[model samples]
Target: MNQRALFAAAAATVLSSALLNMAPAAAQDMGKDMGKEKCYGIAKAGQNDCANLSGSHSCAGQAKTDMSKDEWKYVAKGTCKQMSGLTADEAKMSMTKKM
Candidate 1:
């Protein structure tokens, strides 16, 4: 390839990789939303849900809150880790678990 063509290809490759890296962060944000919503539903019953959510690529830790006084006093929040090989199904399962 000519110098100009080669440079263009390199730029494209870099941009593609950057976007790929960002995708996991986006997906994790979505998963966190899912987990937080589920946490709300379970919070009333005072249950701790610790499902691994990051598609097995990364395991996002659960947010810890003190539930000493009342169930509503504490809440769990989850955020997906930014990484590759994570699937939607895995994220869903991580967010929604029977407690």
Candidate 2:
């Protein structure tokens, strides 16, 4: 292979190796949520943890407004109320009342 082609292949291998190493750490971070609970009405714009209570979006980080009742984030268990956030059911009910 030419020097340029060899350099490109080496760079690709290094980048892929680095990304593979990161996968385990990312999964470990997700595992930290085992004891967490969903806290609604606390996620800032584009910071939601997963699908929202509303059917508008089906993915995380799609919230358009801060403290939206439909958006949620994972907080330590039993702290949702302390954080001025609501439970899933409460958020759903609140959304219902606004309609």
Candidate 3:
């Protein structure tokens, strides 16, 4: 390959390698954040966390119903049970009322 092409290939390879190495480290950093709390029944439809408890799906933004009792999302710790937010029990109650 020409010198310019060789240089571009080398740069791309290095960038790709750096990104691969960073992925796991970024995931670890995310796990270390203990301030997050899982708040159940507060997520709007299509806005829950990574997955539903019932194994219906394994991705966020896939919830079929809003404020579902079994749905949960992580928020700042203690924020979910505040006066404005609903605790897990409270969420279940709200869902029961709507049913």
Which candidate number has the best lDDT? 2
User: Which is the leading candidate under TM-score?
Assistant: 2
TM-score of 1: 0.36
Best of the two (1, 2) by lDDT: 2
Model 2, total clashes? 0
Every candidate's lDDT: 0.39, 0.83, 0.70
TM-score of each: 0.36, 0.67, 0.53
TM-score-better candidate, 2 vs 3? 2
Clashes of 3: 0
Candidate 2 residues lying further than 4 Å off, grouped into runs, are 1-33
RMSD of each: 14.4, 6.0, 7.5
Candidate 1: residue 78 lDDT (0-100): 36
Worst 10 residues of 3 by lDDT: 23-32
lDDT string for model 3 (3-76, tens) is 99999999999998887666534533452396776677777898876566556766667889987777777778
The runs of at least 3 residues in candidate 1 whose Cα sits more than 4 Å from the true structure, single-residue gaps closed, are 34-99
Candidate 1, pairs of clashing residues: none
Models sorted by TM-score, best on top: 2, 3, 1
lDDT score, candidate 3: 0.70
TM-score winner between candidates 1 and 2: 2
Clashing pairs in 2: none
Q: Which parts of model 3 have CA positions greater than 4 angstroms off?
A: 1-34, 83-99
